[model samples]
Target: MASSWDNRVAFVVRYLYDIDCNGYLDAHDFHCLALRSCVLEGKGECSKARLQKYQHIMLSLWEEIAQLADFDKDGIVTVDEFKQAVMNCCVGRRYEDFPQAMRAFIESNFRLIDLNNDGILALEEYRYDCVQRIVVEDIKIIDEAYYSLLNDDDRRRGGITLTRYQELFAQFLGDQSDDCPAKHLFGPLEL
Candidate 1:
């Protein structure tokens, strides 16, 4: 029971990631990840302890913005809202919001990602090469619903500037924007 529950928790975390649980690189998987993580709780495999940590991380990472699908204020993450968030994050030119993040913060984050000393990217790395632009009002608009629920320290590293905030946002956005094959939670469809 515990292991199965852990896998589900991890699955929510995976969905919260830039990629899906199976590591497929696309909005499809990312979105699927969000829904399961958020709205699909309390049904045997869903509960408080099951998703507490995952909620904390997601709020911190996404800057507490409420995705369209995240109708409920719970932090676990929902597939529809997750997909909506991913689409909003990636629908820019070369991830235009990257530059909005703080320079030093972005540089430090880059070092952590470029671990192999190679200019190329690798797996499990969540850094963005593009600069994205996020309107403060727009961010506020999106987060209006779930703002207070994510105010706890469980989801943040204290205070983050607008630029530093944008940097993290862009990295997370780019992480799931790929062309990989999809993985199905309902099991694979028969041909």
Candidate 2:
């Protein structure tokens, strides 16, 4: 009953979000909010104040991203719903297209990476805080994918402004193919 494009979307979605290596994209990918608790406990390199900010930002990202597959609004994306969302995207019903959904996801991610809240993200922030934070074995691929979203001149500029970040994010979410470097975040792709 599924078309080739739908299958491709499913494959890409699985390849990009199955953080547990268990072929599923559920709330577990958010790591049970341990990162939040760690920050609250001052258990990381960032100061309590900075981590506090990250806590809110990360939570928002988790909620928005998870909602993409939470068809029933139950706060969890069952494997079935996850597959359905991918199929839906193939038909031009992308969850990322929703303004509120995309805004919340992007804003939270930018805020989390922009620890200084200076409205700009330094290269270190993009490389370490943003890319490194991804729970994947081959971070190099994620790094490549992220940088690929920017122009060479932009990369050379040494930092990304909020506007540039939005552009990069749009490119990232718009591409759903296996070669879309951002797909490396969940791990390597088989197709």
Candidate 3:
């Protein structure tokens, strides 16, 4: 059986690496990164300062994710490499205590998912990006219950901050739910 910590770590890693939203880590996500780099490179008519800022951010993120996922040192990460890298990362750390590089990857992906840049993940955003992909009915039920556990104001506001996300995952440590909602975020576990 997957331990509670295992489930949480897997959830966070899934949130970071599953960029194409097809429910698996693969080269397509890398292609998406490359395409973004191209956009930054070709932002000719856009403001130079804005383009430069985005370019630098994209380069940094590309470097970090490529370094982690590209295990064969072949300049690309295969599906196996992606899974191995995620499994190896933050092994000694708890759910919310991801290393700086891992945290950066999470934040980078979170920025992509947050769409409006409002510093929060609205309900629909979270539902579409993370929840809807999960197939198990019981797990979805758990997700709904956990989401309801958020503060009334945050629930009403339509989303939670990144800190609030981490907090909720941590809260799962004490929760006696048969299956964790956080785990469902990544889809069904093998256990």
What lDDT does each candidate get? 0.35, 0.52, 0.53
Candidate 3 Cα lDDT to native: 0.53
C-alpha-based local distance difference test score of model 1: 0.35
lDDT of 3 by residue, 50-167 (tens): 4455445545655676788776677655555654654565443355664454455445545655767788876556655545344455546545644654577677776777776655
Better candidate number, 2 or 3, judged by lDDT = 3
- Give the Cα error of residue 101 in candidate 3, in Å: 4.2
Ten-residue region with minimum lDDT total, candidate 1 = 180-189
The TM-score values for the models, in the order shown, are 0.29, 0.51, 0.52
Candidate 3 residue runs with Cα over 4 Å from true position: 1-31, 34-51, 92-101, 115-117, 128-158, 166-181, 186-191
At residue 97, what lDDT does model 3 achieve?
Answer: 64
Root-mean-square deviation per candidate: 18.3, 6.4, 6.5
Candidate 2 displacement at residue 71 in angstroms? 4.5
Ranking of all predicted structures according to lDDT, beginning with the best and ending with the worst: 3, 2, 1
Ranked candidates (TM-score, high to low): 3, 2, 1
lDDT (tens digit, per residue) of candidate 1 on 127-164: 11111111223333323312321233414633233333
